[model samples]
Target: MKQLILAEKPSVAKDLSRVLGANQKHKNYYEGPKVIVTWALGHLLGLKMPEDLNKEWQTWKMETLPMIPKQIGIKPLPKTGHQLKAIKQLAQRKDVSEAVIATDAGREGELVARWILEWVRFDKPAKRLWISSQTDKAIKAGFANLQPAKAYDNLYQSAIARSKADWLVGLNVTRALTVKYQDNLSAGRVQTPTLALVRQQERKIETFRPQTYYVISLEVGEERGKRVQANPYEIKDQQTAQGIVQQLGNGRVDSIVEKAKTESAPLPYDLTEIQREANQRFNFSAKKTLSLVQSLYETHKIVTYPRTDSKYLTQDMKATMRERLQAVADFSPEVKTYIKNGAVVQQKAVFNDAKVSDHHALLPTEQKANYAKLTSDEQRIYNLIVSRFLMLFAAPHKKVQQKVTVKFGKEQFIFTQNKIVEAGWKTSEEQRASTIQWQEGMTVAPNFSIKKELTSPPKPLNEGTLLGKMEKFSLGTPATRAEIIEKLIKSELMERTPAGLQVSPKGKQLLELVNPSLVSPDLTEKWEKQLEAIAKGQFSSKAFLQQIEEDTKQLVKEVKQSEQKYQDFSLTQKKCPECGEFLREKNTRDGKIYVCSSAECSYRRRKDPKLSNHRCPQCHKKMEIIEGKNGAFFRCKFDGITEKLPTKNEKKKKMTKQEERRLMKKYSQEEPQESPLAAALKAAMEKQ
Candidate 1:
């Protein structure tokens, strides 16, 4: 009898088929003598929506809310029903005596396969194929030692509990708020708290008042002409700052102290760390970084799983470090030197089994990466991962910190300097610090000055800082944090600007309307702790879910009873053509739009004016095409130049080849006089 193998994705299934010698491709699966392989497109089943369970739940009403069902049913995703049917048929085949789960090796992966099996009612002996990398060697080894599916029963229970809790809390709270407020606002157990973080920062920024402050500094020198500056003394009052500066005029160095310091290499990249670094260095959003890393893992097969939270490798991975290092060396010449010189050290900081979770830290696989095949963004992410991995095997960075104290009258001023003693693993140009020399107890004349500055407000939260905050708060798992940030942006609750994530007016209002329990990160942290316990078989899913159901009911009750009001700030005078409802102005990352305020209305219109190819005569920038009651016109913001847009039949006449040749020759001979339109056309042709 053949064993049916179910994979998480088609690419993975294809790899399994090749390694298992199941080369016979059927409609939706591969077949061979010993095994047959089929795949799921991520997840083919999800918890049924409230409306799907009963007809009464269709309408948005607070009375029907806290719609907790005794049994949350799972249904095949409508779009992927065909693939589900195919897998079901294969699982129940007469010749198939057993099934194998070959999905991703994590909590979510377990859910993907178990949900499908439950939906299909495929009762058979089942085993699991768990492996980190998709390399053929790993796959073959995994198949040689398959574990019973029962081994991950706790993991599956945890996954199911998470889904059910999200549905109960997210859907119920969202419905309650939408019905009570008469607007479509969303809230989730995890996402709401994440949004509250941004809102919290917004509150801080709005209430902050800048104050002027001053600092007095003294410059002193030691013997051998080595100079060191004293630390600035902060003064809140201008008069005091000026007095201190006057008192410290021409100060002399009284003492010098030096301390040696060593900084170990940074730990390897976990999903969050890499996402944060990518955001900081390339301005790539957290979601974008996750996508690039996932591609490198699944498509290129050069990196390990991307959703891991651990930053340390397993003890077993030490055996393969040399092979992994060789692959990294192929990408970087400096890494090649480290390999050649045998500089790779097995530091305990990077190799600890106890710290690892479902998967070890992200690492370069033994697969040799073809740099040419990677996109520019992928190359950047890959470089970051490889560099961090290589740094694990290098020496610690060493430096000396020197502080000089100067005495003028009764007050003392200090200057600090840091000098690098060894580059170590911090070999990058940006990591090096300048060196300074100074001797102890040497006296020299010093300059003094008062520097005035304004007390700054807290900087806005970028993707990196936001992720860091979420991590600190235990807001969401590394796998789901990026998606949470994206949902807030998509709902128009937050916006990404050059200044960083700014909470929208709607977002602030939503927070005010939400229950304090729902917006606190402490709630998510509590849920996560319980979920971890559930995964380890120490906590009961039933009890955890029961508490969530009670909490969800309480949240709905609070929303229904609150006298607080929410104004639809997005509402506009313009009406939706289809629904006759007042349109609301909404800002999206792409541009602005006017969407109907009514939840039942599915109408939206673009609000941004179209840009024409015509260039401005003054600034050479494209002009905007604005449509008014009178007619369409081209206006240039650069110079406020407005011109009537040409009619469809009044297109510019195409120049003949002879005319073009004459123009090119004329321009080549002398600077040619041309209109902005003519110059734009010429530039476009040259680009071609």
Candidate 2:
């Protein structure tokens, strides 16, 4: 009898199949004598929609909302029905005696596989395969010690509860707001709170008032002729600052004191921390950073799991420290010298069992990296992980921190300097400190000056700062934070600018419309705490879901009762053909479209420029086809050129079948002639 194995995606399935010796490939699975392997394309099934649960919930009416189903059901996604059918058939085959759930080892991964098992009704006993990396050795070891499927029941229950809660709250509140406001608006347990955070930052920027301040500085020299600068105090009044500067014609060094200090290396990257750093250093979006790291984990097999929250390694992984160090040292010769000199030390800061969760911090795996295969962004991220890992084994940076006080006619000024004692783990040139010398009681008269400045407002929220705020408030899980940001952008509530993320007018309006409880991050934090407990088997999923159901009812009622009005900012002058109502301009992923303002009317028209495969003769770029009072024409935005399309009567002179065949044969044999019309037709056919 064969043991069937299921994975979360085709890439992972291929890895498992290679390790399991499943050589024979079927249409949707790989089979060997003893095991058959198949995979899911992420989630093949999702929770049933509200309309699917009850026919009455089909229309967007306020009365139909708060539609909670007693038993939430699941259905296979329409697009992936074929793959689901193959998995179902494979599970029920007479030769298959048992199943192995080899999807990702996280809650979402467990849900992906278990939902399929439920929909397929696979009765056979099942086991779970949990592994952190996609390395062949890890896969082999994982398969050798698979755990009983029942062990992860709590995790699956937690996932189910989270999904159902999101559905109940997200769908109900979204519908209520849309129905009451007569505009397309959405709210969620996590996304709304995140948006509120952005709006909060924007409010600060809007209300901020800048104040002018002044500082008096004195430059004093030591016995060795070395100079030191000091800004002793800040004066809020410009007149006071000028008075002090004038009284102090010059400054003399009064005293010098020195103290030694050491700074430990920063902890390794958690998913959120890495996302923040990537955004700050590379200007990469949170989603882009997540995608790059995920590829490094699953595709390159060079890094450990990417969607982890822990910043330290578990104690058990301590045994592999030397091997991991060696792997990282292979990339840099300086790192190699450090390792060769026995610099790798077992530090508690790097390894602690208590801090680790389902996965450890992001680290370079023991696998040797092939830098050539990685993209530029991947190379940068890999270097960051490896650098952090190397620092864990190196010594702390040491320096001498010095503070000097100088006096100018009763007023005192202070100057601070840092002298590096040792480079230690800080190998970067910027971190290296230069030396400054000073002697106690050595004094010399020096220059004085007054500087004027204004207090600046808090900077706008960028993807990095926004992620930091989310992490601070426990707003969302590391796995879901990037997606929340993307959702806000897609909903047109937030926009990206060089300054940072800015709240649109509609976003401010959303905050005004949403209830305080719904917009507070505390709500999400409390739910996450409960979700964690449920995963640990300390809480009940049923009870948590019941709470969500009650919360949804109250939330919908508050939205319905809101006396606030919504202004249609997107309204256009165009009138709907079906109903005499003003049309509103809406931007979709494909392009912009104008829809009727009347909720009852379904009239909509595309307003974006129509893209055609016609090539422009001047710039060799695609031209846009436009319709005007003069009939059809092609316009090239690149070169500001326009050409009228041939009239139908003028275009009636067509080529014979033999001539067409001859032209096709000539084009196939060589590159097409570079004529305006011919090139356009060639580009169009190539697109087809």
lDDT of 1: 0.85
Instruction: Please give, for residues 370-451, the per-residue lDDT of candidate 1 as tens digits.
Output: 9889999999999899888888877788888877776666777666766778877888624323243445555546465567
Poorest 10 consecutive residues of model 1 by lDDT?
220-229
lDDT score of residue 439 within candidate 2: 62
Q: Best TM-score goes to which candidate?
A: 2
Kindly report which residue stretches of model 2 are placed more than 4 angstroms away from their true locations once superposed: 222-234, 246-255, 407-411, 429-437, 444-446, 616-621, 627-688
List per-candidate RMSD values in Å.
Answer: 9.8, 7.7
Model 1 scores a TM of 0.84
* Pairs in steric clash, model 2: none
Per-residue lDDT of model 2, residues 326-345, tens digit only = 77766766777766766555
Off by over 4 Å in 1: 221-234, 248-254, 340-346, 429-440, 576-581, 586-688
